[model samples]
Target: MLYINQQKSALQASTLADLAEQLALPTQGVALVLNRQLLPRALWAQTPLSTEQDHHIEIFQLVAGG
Candidate 1:
């Protein structure tokens, strides 16, 4: 099982892109971090999730404020 935003998740995904899709994340104004590293949007499709290891995925929403 993997952790999403510090919460336990049973959802299984082959790639980062798949995970994002499963979560219905916005295309913009959001950032994804995997294993303490910032994952670029372009790499999401190529990044694979390993079942052998537990992963930690963090999603940060971009906000605009004064």
Candidate 2:
């Protein structure tokens, strides 16, 4: 049982893409950082996340371009 902090959803997912799907957020609009490392958007679908391991994930919503 992993504990994801500061996250709205309670679903236990291994990847950001799964989390996004559970949270109903677009994968392209959010930025995720794990353990202080910035995860590239291209790797979101494959990057594994662990809440029990004390991962620091920073999520930012991207604004549409003008």
Candidate 3:
């Protein structure tokens, strides 16, 4: 099971990119924090989530306003 923003998500995804796709989270204005660490966009496709344990994925949205 994957824990996203402290909420459990049943969406099946191995990588951050996949997770974003499944959750409908925009990759352009979002930042991912996996396992309490910042995840680089370059590594999102390569980084794998562990199935043996619950993984924490925090999504931070960046908004622009004037």
* Per-candidate clashes, comma-separated: 0, 0, 0
Where does candidate 1 stray beyond 4 Å?
64-66
Using all chains and alpha carbons, the TM-scores for the candidates as numbered come to 0.92, 0.60, 0.83
| Comparing 2 and 3 on TM-score, the stronger one | 3
- At residue 24, what lDDT does model 3 achieve? 84
User: Candidate 1, clashing residue pairs?
Assistant: none
Model 1 lDDT per residue over 1-66, tens place: 799999999999999999999999999989999999998899999999999999999999989998
User: Pick by lDDT: which candidate is best?
Assistant: 1
TM-score quality measure for candidate 1: 0.92
Report the Cα lDDT for residue 24, model 1.
Answer: 97
lDDT of 3: 0.84
Q: Which candidate's TM-score is highest?
A: 1
Models sorted by lDDT, best on top: 1, 3, 2
What lDDT tens digits, residue by residue, belong to model 2 across residues 1-66?
A: 333445544567888777667767664667666666777778778987776565555667778999
Task: Between candidates 1 and 3, name the one with more favorable TM-score.
Answer: 1
Which residue runs does candidate 3 get wrong by more than 4 Å?
63-66
Q: Stretches of candidate 2 above 4 Å error? A: 1-9, 63-66
